[model samples]
Target chain A: DVKVTQSSRYLVKRTGEKVFLECVQDMDHENMFWYRQDPGLGLRLIYFSYDVKMKEKGDIPEGYSVSREKKERFSLILESASTNQTSMYLCASSRVLGGNSPLHFGNGTRLTVT
Target chain B: AQTVTQSQPEMSVQEAETVTLSCTYDTSESDYYLFWYKQPPSRQMILVIRQEAYKQQNATENRFSVNFQKAAKSFSLKISDSQLGDAAMYFCAYRKGSGGGADGLTFGKGTHLIIQP
Candidate 1:
């Protein structure tokens, strides 16, 4: 079984604060992803990294950035958190891209910006 | 770019009955993969079933099975004898054939399944 561990299950931050959400996968998967999920709107990809130190913007990457300093770790940084940014963020990892690999997701971080 | 669509935002079914969730996708590529993922309340999202484009046979997992219409570009999940535990948000996703460049699942808005006892 693969484990995608998220640093925080629930987070609360003030507006205009810089927030960091961390994710680490035990499996040495080659791909990692960050997503924002909201009611009515499923999981929207924010960022994805295919290799260490390599990242790509997803469908919605406006106010977010990602860092993959290590193979097992991927981090999502919110440069400036706002009330509109409050939503559930998910982290996922996959063995590789081509093998019909299903994403293994973390428990998710419910972020609240007030 | 490929896109997935789950027209039904919510569905309700009785326990011990069967329910089907509809999913359709648009893609110009001949080869790709479709997936159904479930996210329960306060639980991590998990894969329910997956279908490959080239395969004629549909994918099934226990009571969960998929109705794959390649020509129609439609993939629907049918759960037999639904249980309370089956209640969750089910997402339909599409992934292009693996070669290089862009690689990641394109997801639909998702359908919320409600099981009635």
Candidate 2:
């Protein structure tokens, strides 16, 4: 079985504060993704990393950035937290793209910005 | 760009009954992959079933199966003998084949499944 672990299951931050969400995968997958899930809108990709030090912007990448210093860990950074940034964040990893590989997702972190 | 659509936002079914969740996608490419992912109250996304465009046969995982209509570009999920544990948010997703530049899955808004007692 593949295990994806997120650093925090729940978090709260004040407006204008910076926040970090960490994720680690035991499968050593090459692809890691960060997504924010909101009610009615479903899950939207924020950022993704294909390899160490390589990152790409997804559909919704405005106030967020990501870091992949190592193969097993991926971190999502919120430059300036706002009330609108409060939502459930999910991290997923896959062996490689363009194959039959399916993404294994973490439990998710629900962040609240006040 | 590819887009997935799930028209039904919410659906309900009684125990021991069957329910179908509809999904439609628009893509210019001929080869791609379709998936049905379930997110329960625990907020963990689980792959329920997956279908390849090249294969005519529908994908099935035990009580979970997909009705894939290639030409119509529709893929719907059918859950048989619904249980309380089946209540969750079901998302429809589309992914292009190996040769495409886009590697990630494009997901729909999702349908919330409610199981009645």
- TM-scores, all models, native as reference: 0.96, 0.97
DockQ of 1: 0.68
Candidate 1 lDDT tens digits, B22-91: 9999998888999999999975999999999999999999999999999999999999999999999999
Alpha-carbon deviation at B49 in model 2, angstroms? 0.3
Count steric clashes of candidate 1: 0
Docking class of 2: medium
Interface residue Cα RMSD of candidate 2 after superposition? 1.6
In order, what are the TM-scores of chain A for the candidates? 0.98, 0.97
Candidate 2 TM-score restricted to chain A? 0.97
Best by DockQ: 1
The best candidate by TM-score is 2
Error of 2 at B75 (Å): 0.2
